[model samples]
Target: MELLPRRPDRLFPVLLRWMAIGMLSLLAHRLVFLFMYVFQAVRLEPELQDGAVASVLKALFVGLRFDLATLTIWIGPFALLLSLTAALYALPAARLRYRLLNSLFFHAQWIWLLWLHLVSVASTYNFSVNGKHLGWEFAAYFRDLPVLLAGSFVKDPVPTTMLALFIPVWVGAGFFVDRRLSVHAGAADGHPNPGRKALLTALLSPLVVLIAAVVLFRGGLQQNPLRPGDAMSESSPFLNNLKITGTYLIVHDLSDRGDFKTFYPPEENTAFVQRMLNDGRPFVDPQYPLLRRMEARRRMPGRFATIAGPGLPGRPDRQPNFVVLLMESWSAKFLESHGYSAEVAPNFNRLAHQGVLFENFYASGGRSANGLFSILTGIPDRAGRTILRSSRIFNRFGSLPLLLKKKGYQTLFVHGGDLHFDNLDTGLPHLGFDHLAGMKEMEDSGLYSRRWTMGFHDEDMYDMLLRKTDELYAGAPERPFFAMAFTSNNHHPFGLPDPSFAIFPESDPEAAFKNSYHYSDYALGKLIDIIRTKPYFQNTIILIVADHSHHANLDYLQDREIPLLVYAPSFFQPERRTDIAGQLDLLPTLLSLSGGDSPYAAMGRDLTVPAERPFAFFAGGSNTDIIGMMRDGFIYYHYLRSSQSILLKGTHPVDMRDMQAEQPQLAVELDAMTKHYYQFARSLEKENRIWPESISE
Candidate 1:
């Protein structure tokens, strides 16, 4: 009996150990994902109650599947290496080398695990503030790492410290686990017929593991691979978002750039988009579908009527001086006028009473650059990389600033941050501005504060605006000016130079944000006071609007809703309009108000005139390829990848229930319209046809 004892199979133990290590790594990923889920659930406690619990649990299960897929894909190469090492272990001469390579591979796997953990942690904060996971857009922040890190540490030290400490602990834990695994692996016995058994095991084991990995990586035996859209739950966007892991998003984003796959013919897309934007008018050109001749809708009767401009024909009124204040992260939800209990925007509220406020106005996208692009070009943000950051930025457009410049107006663009930060320094000038000013200019004036990481405080930016306007006015008082001032203090890290503006206690969750909002409002009031004392105040038309809403716990539609105010007591009547409008409407609306009959191409209509049926189009930011349309008191969301659509009723409290089931036809129609809108814009930009070829660069 003692002579009949058989030796252990060497291949089986190696394969088992690999599987065990893989499972442990997967468990680690699951733990981090659960932590994020708990964080989100706690933050959105009020919203996720009752039946939402089951939906949340279902989403967690879906998330586990995605985590499995992500892990399998990531460890596929390591699995191959393990199989190779196992085959070599059959030879006594290669045994030592196999052990060394296996150990190295194990450590490499730990490094990858650490990376996944860090990205998941970062995504938690991103979701908390931006209502999204980490995607390719986050890569842009790496360019300004110093400022980003400084701001994070200054604003939220506790989380920053925790993240810093996580690295060493993770590494130490990896070492401990490796030591235990090493001991166990060493205690295993070798096979009787080493060479033949190891070779056979290597061949068969790799084939089995490869098939299993491929199945898991694809998320099942389904015809198609898993997609972010597959995780979407019609009942709860929060649950839908929860089902998507950061690793999946980052990898998906890198692999797919949301390129125009052309769902419909170019002609079909053009016709639909033209019909939507034509406003019952005829198209000017066969080649240019969006181009139309805009006629002035208003006549000015004032002292400035004596001044002449090309757009103002016989009436002979000077084009109104334009001062657009592109406020940063100014959510309508933070304003008293918008039913917010807080008096965080008293100054804006006061101005709203003296201006034509568009209550149903929404942003084109969820970023500053998106707002700027839409406001200037009258086009909604297209899917994929932002136009400002893409090579297509050089494409000529019928931008309002450029059109105004052609009408003998002096154009200037000023920002509170580094103009170079978002390529604004290069892109703004290329868009149309004759002059550009930013942090460098402010610093030269000695008003810049080093304490502010992004830029100087909002008050300092306001002062710079005043100074810049004065210079423009003094240089050519006869010429109307088109000046844009982009603010920065209301953004993340929410820093304030003056502590007096702190309205909430430090114990409050959004204390820093509330304080910054109050400070920006204070600056707005001061700027208005100074403007009222100037002579140009009588002729200047000032617009106060947000780049986008502050990303908070809300439905998708509500997140895009922002405040739009047109202030000029002498020109526009003080009225509150309930018509749906967006940042895209800014250019055409402003052109019509100023008595300009410029030939332009735009996707938006003049909001000054009432539309029998008005709608707004929005792109789900860089994180997702979702196109949305708000029409007929309902919002339609079309998820491109999974061909999924959601229709929601109402705005304030959007009914999260899927109305698409009851109204399938309407959903299909709206989905087609939204798709056409996005594809049309994308095609035009790519073809460099947004503007007529006659317009020279």
Candidate 2:
């Protein structure tokens, strides 16, 4: 009677209904995540902290006032869409269990979206400042692969874990809606119903298509993403244009490390693709040999000077433990007139008082990596990439440190971020360093930012640095050592550390710069104190320089323009140097200062004494390079592409084209210098050798 109340039939339909609902919800969830990826392409990295969410919720208590209306402008549309989607997802389902399954599906989508946001932040925020393509620098990360695969193996693990976590959340949300909102809305149909059969058939083909699309798209974007040679070939006709534009972009991106006003359209983007492609062309000609190198001499003066070698580093009678501190984002203009204000480094000011301060020292490049390359190798970044990226250029880079090590100086490098991020770990050892230290190398990894949104707070870096100083210099036969310290406090995301947290700024950019400088100074003071305790206090040489200009604050000026100050406890204190010098001169100058033999093919003359040449710094591109040269109490700004030159007198701009054109011989001489610089760089890259014995001034 009553059809025997067939329980098996009822149970079968109920199960089918749940299975169908789960599949549809999963599909919808994945669709939302795809749009999130599109947002990242334009550099909108959304922050997702539980704390930030809490702050927004608390603002609700502030009342529905007109003041809150302004907050809606930016996120209003997206917020509305998300709300509508959430409401749709919360609709009453046919079965209780099915609703719960659907909720878990939606939550998994959120986990996927979060992973994309993290990557968008990581790549853009981290600053290396080399005028080269960042995409090809990594051993991992193909443009075509799933973003998670583009990163390391570990990068995808957390997202996978989060997806697992979301299943429970999704199931619970579905159950809550079903029991509370849809209990009465359900029909006589159970979990296993005809509805489920239809749902499965509807999605099966599309689902297969979706997966195929992901694979096909990735394949189209990058045929093979991980291989280096893949970057050498242009991906499209558009990419050829991207290469030519990159040369212009390098001046804007790598040098000043600032967004230029797109002097030409694809300024930064073009430069972002130059993976050792010297402005759409390779730096080294394929057939070039080490013996017949330095051929890029006729192109430009900057290239010429860059190719010429600084012959034989002078012998170090007693090469003291040298510590070259490359302070990040520093300005040289502050030291020009009244000296850096309390707004900057007081200790550095004092150090300048005790040391030989290059009043007119200029940085060859506008980036940290670029300036470092110029300083260490005494060659410009004409290789179209960073020295770290092209380790195969020579068996050893410059050999300045390796030679010093032979002279008995232990060498070490210290940086704020992970050294491997830019391949510093792989490349620096070849640069002749005995050791490398970065945030990862430190034992006390501070709770700076797990994400490092702004990167490791400079104060944390300074603290970590001090703790590791002894370990870095441990048991080194008591000979002089060369320690390179890179400071990052003044860098990005611009958040300051608390006084309780570390000795950082009280809260303004001016204060932040001062805080960072102070922290670095204190660390220097501590290192100096250690030197005082050791026997090398009087014999040690400390060179304080900036890797690049403080691009964040243009008003601070002197960005590519920098100061070079050398401090020795009692060795030599010339006090002030009016000689013109660029970062390319650093190696030769230091070698001369330490009395070491000059290396082969260093274009820069020694600046430890007066430099006979004008202060020249080149911004590269086929056109539109901002070349600033100094001569006779005047700074000349020349547009290399357009052949425009200006000599600003005192605080006023003056047309110096005719005046500069007067120096035909000087122009010819500078052209030769630029040629030499390129020749040397090409030699290293093509021949994989450096000739120190056959070098000449």
Candidate 3:
């Protein structure tokens, strides 16, 4: 007897048809991703542009795999149901009922395809605006949908119009495609196979589809499932982003939210962190692991020590006033002092020669919020969450502003943008800011004529800083002040009020960015000029640093590297320090320089004091979960999710080659050290132990 029926089964043709639709849907996703890649490539750096063709091909190949995985997830259940319905069609009695059900499933696939295309278009627009695919920010954007749409129309009308038109047009095309592909499922043959054979085929077909679906959903038979980081083969961030589908990013980021798991015991993590921070000194209290009483080491005798200034209060020593300029997107790579060919920050370069400049300084994380959280609180930015936006913002801390308040210094936070953005208005005050100012305050002043998309121009913000400083001194001239002004003009979309500052031609890809940098530098020069004329200028110390680097096609180390200048010519001598430091060190270093001996909790050490084992810990990568440590002429990167680590040698032009295999022992040591810091940070934040209100408790 024949092993199977001579005629083809009805289920076979229906299953093949469904497979064809699934493949086409996947292909459509690939094409949309290709469009995003090309759109982003328009702004690629010269080096990245040189290898664009090869990178695009590689990214597309990787993107295709992710697309398959995403599509399988989206259509797996429907496909299984269709398979069972088709198998049932092979039965003579149930043919009519199964055909209707099969048709319904096919239409459902068509609707899902339409929705996928719409999401793809929306993600393309999102990439253009934010430089990445849709992620957790989708929820924030959705909540602000009305404002976002209004801004999109006003600021980016071209892409907005195209995306708006795409919806209806794609929906019409979907309808047309569905109608054209409405062919009926194959009818059952009069000569049916034996009932046993039909039932066996029906059972076996769904099982086969289930197995295939499982394999595709996992992307292969690998020991581990595919991840967004797996697509990170290229050094260019844009290329890595292109290689992963939006569906994967959204799901990955959403799932990773609020999941701060502790890998080690609290005691183990606390002990490691305490040892690293104590510098061979004893902890002030056993109840608080990170708390320690630090000595006030004077770097150099200033005029206030001998002159008995107004803020001296019968004591010869008076605290120095602080002016911290948290510059926006001021990447070290764009400064002439940092080896850039262009003089994007001439004022910064001129001032760097008058004070101590940290040549190897890096930001604690990528975002402005990360820099603020790290620099103010002396705590490293936690992976997978921005502390400012999280529930931990309510936690007490030994923040710079709070410590300064204890020293009889007036603390203020000013920004050129809305203080409400990033929850700064509430978080800063909760962290002990005596006063807060933003765009509304500047606008209320009626200071200028022009404004940019973000808010006031850099010059306007600098002017406001001057005014705010004067007000603080007028109210309490005897009290030293700590005022932080965060700039916004150098941010994305690179808006500038004047075009004369453009360093390159409009045709140049980075022309807008160069112009914004130039204008912001000019504003800095203006601020310094006004400050120099003030009587208290000699007693004030200015700290200039970037919130984070601009988003460029750069490797991990290059992206976080930023300039840190402590400018007080009358106090500290001019010197360039090559020591490794990060944003976390700012609070302790500033507090040390301010000459305060109070007990405080800080994860970072004072940069003014030489470190026995110098290292800078940072949170980075596309998802911000990668922990990196730079020490002993080597950089170690550990991906927390995958437990993948790499060791690279050198700093300038960090050699991307993995040295882990050759230096296995060093890698293991550095990896353990890095994880200790990560775990301790999470533990401290979770337990509210960074700085308790009362150490005795």
Candidates ranked by lDDT, best first? 3, 1, 2
Number of residue pairs clashing in candidate 1, backbone atoms closer than 3 angstroms, sequence gap of 3 or more or interchain: 0
Per-residue accuracy of model 3 over 463-566 as CA lDDT, tens digit each: 88888899998888888899999999889878788778877788977788878988998999889989999877888999999998886766666787888988
TM-score of 3: 0.63
Writing each residue's lDDT as its tens digit, candidate 2 over 1-697 gives 0111112223223333433333333332232222223233223323322243343333222212211221122122222233333233322353344434433443453444343323322232211122222332222233423443334224434433444345455545554654433323345423344344334433342334334334432223433211122122221211211121121112222442211212322323223212212321232322221211221111111111122234323443245567787877667655422345553456667677777777766776666767776777765664244444432322334456755665567777877776654456655665677777687655355444532443565555555554545664555435567777787765653344555324444565456555555555555655555656755556567788887776655431244467788777466634676666777776665555444443323445555333344445444322225544444445545553454555443122333344445655655444433333343453344333444323332
RMSD each, Å: 18.9, 17.4, 18.0
**Candidate 3 Cα outliers beyond 4 Å, as residue runs:** 1-259, 302-317, 621-623, 695-697
Candidate 1 lDDT by residue in tens digits, 1-697: 0100011134445445545554554455445445545555656665566566676677677777776777665566676667667666656777556556766876786577566655655654555454556655355444644454455456556655566456546555545654434533343334324556556675566676678778877789864466554554233445655777666667665554564547799888888888788675577777777878766455444211211234454422356799999999888887776788657888898899888888999888888878899999987765555677543565668899888887778898888787755567666776789788898888887766654878777788888888888998998888888899998888988988867889889998877888898989889889988998998898888999999887866456668788998888886667888989999988887777667567888888787666898989888653457778888888888877777788988466667898998888878888888888888887787566788648532
**Candidates ranked by TM-score, best first?**
1, 3, 2
Model 3: pairs clashing at backbone N, Cα or C within 3 Å: none
Tell me the lDDT of model 3 at 470. 93
lDDT head-to-head 2 vs 3, winner: 3
Candidate lDDT values, in order: 0.71, 0.45, 0.73
> Model 1: how far is 322 from its true place, Å?
0.6
Q: Evaluate model 2: give its TM-score.
A: 0.51
Stretches of candidate 1 off by over 4 Å are 1-259, 300-317
